[model samples]
Target: MWWFWTLWAVVALTHCSAMDRNKDKALKLMKQTPLIDGHNDLPWQIRKQFNNQLSKVDLNTIQTTHTNIPKIKEGHLAAQFWSAYVPCDTQHKDAVRQTLDQIDIIHRMCDAYPESFMFATSSQDIMEAFIQNKTASLIGVEGGHSIDSSLGILRIMYRLGVRYLTLTHSCNTPWVDNWKVDTGTEAPVHNGLSPFGKQVIKEMNRLGMLIDLAHVSEKVMNQVLDLSKAPVIFSHSSAYSLCQHKRNVPDAVLKRVRDKAGIVMVNFYNDYVTCSQTANLSQVADHFDHIKKVAGHTVIGFGSDYDGVRRVPKGLEDVSKFPDLVAELLRRGWNDTEVRGALGENLLRVLKDVERVRDSLTKDQPDDVPIPYEQVENACRTNYGYFPLDNTGHSASQSPLVLALATLLCWFFGGSSYSCRP
Candidate 1:
């Protein structure tokens, strides 16, 4: 009996020690790989809090905000895609201007803290920032409204270092219907995506801009996946099968993304993750489980939505709590490689793919020609006329995907002298 009791006590102690070691190992791995968060709304948070005035907020020290330089360091965040989110209420032209302002502020923030931050546009830039002990800052424009239906504006945005663009916000764009605003409403104006909307995807691919599907309808998500030659991303969304939130990705879409070789960066908003008024870090991990089950580990990444949402998962209330989530994942039997993929490697791969697609299209003429207003209106009037997946009913000659591919072929044969550059 004494021997049995002693053996049981030894087993309990060993398990406890193993947990502590795992937690420590998780932190060490984060330091080595450095998390590349897919989205953070600190830029918009600064806009609302300090009126885009960095002087009012001291990021070097901890403030009332969810993110700060110190907290971000503690969390071992190596790179962040800061969201330049304009509200859905902002009118079209104002939304575009405000988005530019939001992006400018992000640049200013990086400049203001040179030692702590560096603006990064490519995966190599992110690695360089990490090696130099600075946080790699990338900008993401959060809504299609920011381009105001102008492809030229989109080009300028990418040139200005905007690496990704969310196709919609909380409201429908003229070319796309948002998930939140279109759900349960009258049939969406565009069943899935308008003719011009498909052009948006093509242009993004040509420009190397990541097409983020965080707020668009499921139909739009599917259409983009079918049309995109490069990888796509969900900058900040969760699994809808788990939360039932319209903002979350459905399982079917997750599988399609896996087929496209894209990634879905999980959101940390409690409501989106758990579909509950109350939530915790475990709830966040449950979302990871569902996404991984549907899409596999290579398609998973983190998009905390920090500073964008009011309530966060309990143990992940702030940027500093990122390591806590990593520790929890490690404890749940995730190995180092899987955890690293979720932290940053998956997103890096997506970025590299986008870059490769852009390089492939460099010889093609730029898609600067805007859709004429009559054509735009005609497409909108014929919204539900054709299935987005099988648009053979529409003239094959008018198909954007066909035109885009044709242009690529022409470029390959040295047939294009016209440059549609911005």
Candidate 2:
């Protein structure tokens, strides 16, 4: 019994020593590099719990379930892409308005707390904000339904400071299939990218928006990789090779990400990472390890999806626990370069590359393809101010007096490269 007690003391002291060493390493790394989280849904949380009102509560004093000013500061989050998330329930009804509302609140949050947060639209902006000792807040439209099949809306969103677009959520958009292609009972409508979907990819590339592949289907994943000229990002996804979840990125796609010079910011959702309602810090690290093994060290980053999901892995319960996760990684033998790359450098590199692609395409023709007439008409809440009519005021038809504007739109933009179905 005495020997057992002495052994326990030694084991406990060793554990504490290891934890302290890792924590120090994590702190040192975060201080030196900009730790940019690929996705956070604090805006969605504010919209839901606070009715999009910042005046009612102070992020400085009030504590949220997963995120807050103190937790963010403790976590050493230099930048975050606040997700403009609208539920799939709003797909055809009010997705656009809801997304805008979410984005508005995100802006309001940044404006409300200028001391802690600043609006950033580019990689350089993020670095500048970090140097100023502020968190760089960027916007990401979570689901394509927000676009309502209008490429015009997408462009307008980019001008509004939205930097990335998650091609789909849990449900399918008119243009792209979602992860449900593997999990749903129904057959896929497009199988992969519809004609309009291709235009979306092209337009996003032109706008320098990061093509986020998190919630898209496997086929859509491949199609996007094939179509997008810029390096893509799985804004909040993990390696499917470990979990076999449809929501996770498959190894085939990870290889494509590697070849395309993309990044996968590993998600901390329990079901995606552990396939269970519970997981620990080690389980999350396992994902980073697996992704690093398959996609290499540079392709890995963190997207905790904080405040977006109800359940998360244990030990990574809040935004403040990021350092703990880093510590675990360090304990598992991750060197400084590898750790720094995963922390923020890799994402910064991807952002710069995306901007480069945009610069390179400055002289190129912009995408002309509009969303197919039927797709928008069926899904959008309103069709006012849509495409104009023919000279004879005739609707879309195979008429000789000039086919419907829809037909003309398809012909004008789709050409032979797109199916342009109405």
Candidate 3:
């Protein structure tokens, strides 16, 4: 009996020792290869903390934030797609202006910390930033609303070094339904991508900007996979099969992403990563495992969604804890190469492919024309009829005067006017 007890203790000790060895091994692997996180909301954090002023925040040390210069270094983060996120509630023109402010903050933050950060607009730029021991700062606009139905704005965003643009956020864009609305939280505006939404993808390909499908409905995701000339990404999403969250990517979508040779960078938000309320670091690894199994190892990567979500997985509460995830993957039998791919290689490959598509389109002129404003506004009007806003700000859904005016306008406009249904 004593001998049996001793043997059990030895077995447990050996298992612990093995875990330590794998964790150590994972850390070493991260140093050799860069860990390019697809999304981080530090720019928003700065907006909240310092009112969009970089000087008010000291990133060199711990400062009540998930992402800081020191935390980024500790996490082995080589490159980051800083989210130029503006709330979807800030509609149309205001959303566009706020997005510009977010972009400006990102550029200034990178410039303010030149020694610790360097701006990266291309895959090569990311690698160069890594080589220089600086974290690459790549910009990713969070919603299509930022462009305000203007292809010209999209082109300008890309020229300003924006590498990716999420097709929608929590709310549906005029041309696309978002995941949240499609999940029944709200009425969907465009059941999927409308004609104009497809045009957005084409312009993105022409400009070399990666189409981020994080917050879009699955219908939109499938539509994009079918139409995009370049590989697309889900900048910060998890596997819906694992957690059943609407914010997560479905299995069917995962396979499509793999077929496109694109990547789905896993999100680390506790709610998205796990079905259980208590999310641990291991659950984060579980998402990586599930995506790799369903999508193949080539298309798996990390997006983290750091500073974006209110609750992060335990042990991955900040950017500094990234090595912990790498260690978990190693413990789960992932090889150094596969681990490296999840860390950054897969995203690099996709970004390079997007750039190649853009280069192929260099001779093509920009899709610079703006989609007409009234067309966007009336896209969801029932029976092609709209309710006019009264002086007190109430919508007059059945005003005879409004209906008569709409009929008169339709008669004069001809083809541009939609026929009002009874």
Candidate 4:
């Protein structure tokens, strides 16, 4: 028994030593380069659990959730795309307001921890944060519902420092189908993308927003690959070939993403990683490896859905487990270059490229493509708007009520309102 105990102790000590070495190497690489994660739902978690009260919740304290300042520091995360996730319930009603609140919460979260976090909207900002040893908190809207099918709302969100927009969630927006289309659970509303949805992609390109295809249907994914001029990303998804989940990216789409210079940021939810409730770190790494095989290493990144899912992979249990995954990659013979790119460089390059596309479209006027009323007309929708424009795009409506209002305006404002040119 004494000999057995001694042998077990030796083996345990050797294992600990190896893990320590791996952690040290991973930490060293991350310190020099920015380790950016594509998606996190800490904002949503804070909203639900803490009532959006940062004063009541301590980011420094380790809570039951996956995210906390201590775990984030331990994770060596240089940049994070905090998801401003509006629920499907808010889609037609108040998704925009909820999304705005989420963004505000993220901003406040950064402000609360000024020393540890800072708002970042570009690759350069990420690099600066890396140099300054602060977490670059970038914004990502988790669903197109957040924009309520309005390009105007989308533009405003982009102006608010939201760097990416997921085209769908569990529910489809009026202009796009969600993953349910592939799962055979819900029929697609837009087939792939409505004409308006295509415009959303174009507008996002012009705004330099990274088009996130995580929760979109397979048709939508293929459509976006064909449509978007800028590099797209699956901000938090895994390999469909492995998990067989509709939320996961199929291998063919992964190849297409590679061709388009897009990236697929792997998700770490146990179900998405292994198609089961219980999974391990190895399973999570398997997703990265499979996506890398199909999409190439440069197109693979991390997007642990921290605080978003309840069941996480075992070894990658919390935000702090990022280095462990990196270490696993190193053990699997991933070179420093591949590891570095996956850490942050690849996503950063995508950001710069998207920005360049926006710059090229600097003189291009915004395409105000509106969703056709027939397509979206339902009990859920209300037609409160008047003055719908025509092909000439003039002040369109001349209803008697409108005319009476115009007559009053003309009487008051020196007859200027009578002009139809507006």
Q: Highest TM-score: which candidate?
A: 2
In order, the Cα lDDT scores of the candidates are: 0.86, 0.88, 0.86, 0.87
lDDT of 3 by residue, 1-422 (tens): 99999999999999999878987887788878899999999888888777897777778874777888888888989999999998886654367778898999999988888999999999999999988989999999998888877788888888899999999989887788888876688887777898889889998998899999999988889999999999999999999998998989999999999999999999988889886567999888998999999889999999999989889888998999998889889989998789889889999999999999999999998775555445665422322224466676546654656656666766565454433211
lDDT of 1: 0.86
Output the better candidate (1/4) by TM-score: 4
* TM of each candidate vs. truth: 0.85, 0.90, 0.87, 0.89
State the RMSD for candidate 3.
Answer: 7.6
- Evaluated against the true structure, the overall lDDT of model 4 is 0.87
Candidate 4 residue runs with Cα over 4 Å from true position: 1-15, 378-422
**Tens digit per residue, CA lDDT, model 2, 1-422:** 99999999999999999899999989999999999999998888888888888788778676766899999999999999999998887876668888899889989998889999999999999999989989999999999988888888998899999999999988888888999888875468898899999988998998999999999889999999999999999999988987889989998889899999999999999988888888888999999999898879989999989999889888998898999999999999999999999999999999999999999889878676677667756311334445555686543343443334444555566464233322
Q: Where does model 1 exceed 4 Å of error?
A: 1-16, 374-422
Assess the local accuracy of residue 105 in candidate 3 as a C-alpha lDDT between 0 and 100. 93
Weakest ten-residue segment in model 3 by summed lDDT: 378-387
Instruction: Please report the TM-score between candidate 1 and the true structure.
Output: 0.85
Clashing pairs in 1: none
By lDDT, the candidates rank as 2, 4, 3, 1
Number of the predicted model whose lDDT against the real structure is largest = 2
| Candidate 1 local lDDT, residue 377 | 42
CA lDDT of 197 in candidate 3?
90
